[model samples]
Target: MSFPAFDAHHPPDKDLIDDCVHCGFCLPTCPTYVLFGEEMDSPRGRIYLMNKGLTEEPMNDQTVRHYDLCLGCMACVTACPSGVQYDKLIEATRGQVERRYERAPEDKAFREMIFQLFPYKKRLRLAAGPLRLYQRFGIGDKLRKSGVMSRIPARMRAMEALMPELQKEQKVPELTEPVGERRRRVGVLTGCVQQVFFSQVNSATVRVLAAEGCEVVAPKDQGCCGALSTHAGREEESLNFARKTIDTFEGLNLDNVVVNAAGCGSTMKEYGHLLRDDPEYAARAKAFSEKVRDVSEFIQEIGAVAERSPFAVTAAYHDACHLAHAQGIRKQPRQTLKQIPGMSVKEIREAEICCGSAGIYNMVEPEPAAELGERKANNILKTGAEMIVTSNPGCMLQIQASLKKMGHDGLPMAHPMEVLDASIRGESVETLLRR
Candidate 1:
């Protein structure tokens, strides 16, 4: 068998690879393995390929293909009894693949476009202008109903369909004071796509934080947290972005840097490790990382001071992989949401399985992402909930697209904070749905 040439830089750690006992714990939890029943797509199988790539074997095209298929959802890490650090191994292997492997021209172009646009808030906002116009004019709806959209590339159609109705951006202010007494001061991350598309979530987050006796500071200049690039194996690029984020948030003597987006929160928490080698930013990165917390996690930790008014809605909670699997934050969000009176938080089937919105995975790997979205949507429908509550913008978009595809777009979804914010403000669940 022919293997691709290897670059010694960013080699997969032998110790981390060895930690995978190959006892099949990760196989059942792996999305790719679940879909194709292919051993090579499983965690241990990928580790084996990483080992081969490190052992002077050519990291052939097929090897790169397997790694590309991985969602990097870290479900395997959550399932493994042995505590195998599959996250580190996969990330390191991805860096190697980017450095040593060559992709098809078209695939390379699509990836470059994503890397260029999605990680920058200004770029995403600028790009959304046309999409907003498309959605506003009902062009997308007409095209889809007439089957013309299907004629477009599947990924392109999927991208078009995934565009949420972009409203005027609700920019988070530089500082928000608490309603009563300020118990703590925190920094909020206004993510790239998040600030543009789901700014409502950020607004709700700030309101909820203030209502809970916290002073929130959202740095106007904060950029992407490098979750997308890091997950994709663009190590150097991700590191640069991480450094910028670290610098932006470090200026505030924040007791906690609150993050509402699951992927951003996960990457921010790992900033210390991502920039551990940078002499200038290493210690600062570690210090900044120590203060990072998922909004739900932070809410639960500090305790919600505001009284939650009743919100009458049956809601299915979809666990974002980064929030649940990556950060072990399954319960905090649920616990925070349950605090709302008259709210029913139903558990969906396969709650631990990824909804396949792993950063930009839905955009790049639309086929598998669509399948997983369908699976998640179906399971969500089974709960008979009026709304699906999740913590990540990616999950919100993916689940909404899947529901639309399944002819069930009537069901509205929300970030947990939105629901909580509604209850706290005595707003009806209808207001949330209408928005």
Candidate 2:
């Protein structure tokens, strides 16, 4: 258990850590704390450990483990009445961990693999080929039935199981002209994983925006927005990605940058905070951050002008943690869903709790992620909704895998944008599914 010397540059803010009154308001909302019933795992407890690590205590395995267990859902931030900035505290702490801690060799390799593969669009595309072939040839099923999957690493097995049914990737053009009078001109973010895996969600988002009389500008070469890197504490890498993303869209002179994925949107909207230290990009990043908007948020602001038809199905809307907690967007997504006639948005218990898809969390920490996923799945199933609707691709995959694991694979799952696109086009559910 070798530990690198603590780096002072990214130490947790003592002022923020001191803000926690330890009121226990966050205990019930923290998924790890609730699951483990360990004081060291709770928000207040982590803040205490952060104080120790920052002041005099040496960084050790126990300290690192507590932080590793956190999902970074920001539910505790939402739950705290004392205005403790747990999000910033956790992020800064993780940055220190990345810079000043030497993880076990295998853990380091796994993280490096994830960072290298996930943040690069082309790498993920090329990597998906073998996975798609495996799924296409029914080898995945054969391996599972033969129990060979059990011999593989837990993280690898989890990733294999959560592999989405591959679809022909849809490419968004440089510019999509609005149908009627263009009320707003917006740039759309085609996320890295979302573009490769759930490309239809981005396509649907563009279609819906165009249908609502918004000109869509989706740059073909724009790269990942650095949500995964930032969430995982690769601060320097995240800043590089943020600078590139700002450079990609800043020249378009668009009214807004629409993001359908919750995590990307949340991080994009914080570009100012991420780059505030950069002398050259500070102002530009602030301006760029201001223009970023979630699709649901943008639609609500502009009002849904497209006449929607009915899709009479009971669906539960799962709040992607970033959307609901980080971005404080709760009503807009539900409001967007309600526009379709006969669409009943049933409320699931613990809607604010994460589905254990905090970026690549389920892949990195399978045990706790699976527990939270199953907890989320059971609550959603109890709602008796025929489908699960969410805005984030990660959450959709997370919930879908959980449901399948629970033997409730019959439930359909989709992004809200997808459903809205279907209604706006008057397409049947069968047609939507086929796509």
Candidate 3:
């Protein structure tokens, strides 16, 4: 196939792109390629454009457009047999786009708004009240139905649709007293989105940690993990946010910095790498990163995790890509669940695949995201699990929405901690929600 001239605006590293062997392994698994039959949208083609863009050639609008459409989902990295390191490639490319590409002001504004509010927990919590008013008056519905978003660019349209639903005002309590024999002391990350939206999940995580014999310290000074900002290539903003988070948690002499949200966990665990340039914080960041753990990893490691799961329930488990593939944490969550005495954790087909919820992708790219979610929902349907367990709040919302659309009722999605809490208490799992 003939290639177009590359644009200088979105430069990828040449060495990384050269590593691609033109293997088709990444094609079948790409949600976009899997849904749409365009080779230009496939991993192989994206790499080709990246190679040209790296060499100072002017990349054509078509080439740049294709790259702009990428969701940066990292599936290509998982699928690439050649180890092309698409993570860095895509991240750098996005940075170049932000610096050199002339995106519409409206588009830039929308993208910046998320970074402005989402990484600041207090700001996000304060805005939730007004957002509820928008939802209550059906303003969002009217705007969406009016097709007003079409007047803007595709990227902006994607951003608008991803607007989060009305959220609750939930902030972490400074300290949660220990419940059982307190064997360990640890800190739990209060994520910006999870704090305001999935307040119950974070609360359940605190309860579970306490029941498992750990003093759960929810430091109000703790800042957002800045995963969303970093993923979007807002380097300066993300670095500041990361530094603040490190500063907040480092003061606590804790065994582990436990995070319930898989996305935040993945980012917090990489603090060492993020702050490597800092002479003072480098060692401290490494030490802190070492302490960082997903709630499942912490539970499995501590061995204080309970096993007397007296409730009988059928549930399907959805693995978060950030937890499983990004952090190499595949077993602990399932193991934690299987330990529950009476519950059966049914295996979901294609468990390794993402359920169309790579951080903010579902809200941003609703069409393709919904398509993949429906496919995942069908797979879950065969398992016939009454409830679904996923570690990340984003996946829970995306899957739950798909389940609702498919007319599955009362199968509210929950975190692994909720079940872990029940198992340790020797109470029915249903009590956590009902009570």
Q: State which candidate has the highest lDDT.
A: 2
TM-score of each: 0.97, 0.97, 0.86
Per-candidate alpha-carbon RMSD to the true structure:
1.9, 2.1, 4.2
Q: For residue 374, give model 2's deviation from the true position in Å.
A: 0.8
Pairs of residues at least 3 apart in sequence or in different chains that clash in candidate 3: 6-58, 6-59, 7-58, 7-59, 162-363
lDDT of 3 by residue, 125-213 (tens): 78777778876898756875798746766655554444455545555677886776778899999888788878877887888888778
Cα lDDT of model 1 by residue, 156-180, tens digit: 8778878887889987899999999
TM-score, predicted candidate 3 vs. hidden true structure: 0.86
Shift in Å, residue 410, candidate 2: 2.3
Please report how far candidate 2 places residue 212 from its true position, in Å. Answer: 0.7
Q: Is candidate 1 or candidate 3 better by lDDT?
A: 1
Error of 3 at 394 (Å): 1.3
The model with the greater TM-score, 1 or 3, is 1
Please give the lDDT score for candidate 3. 0.75
Query: After best superposition, candidate 3 residue 228: deviation in angstroms?
Result: 0.2
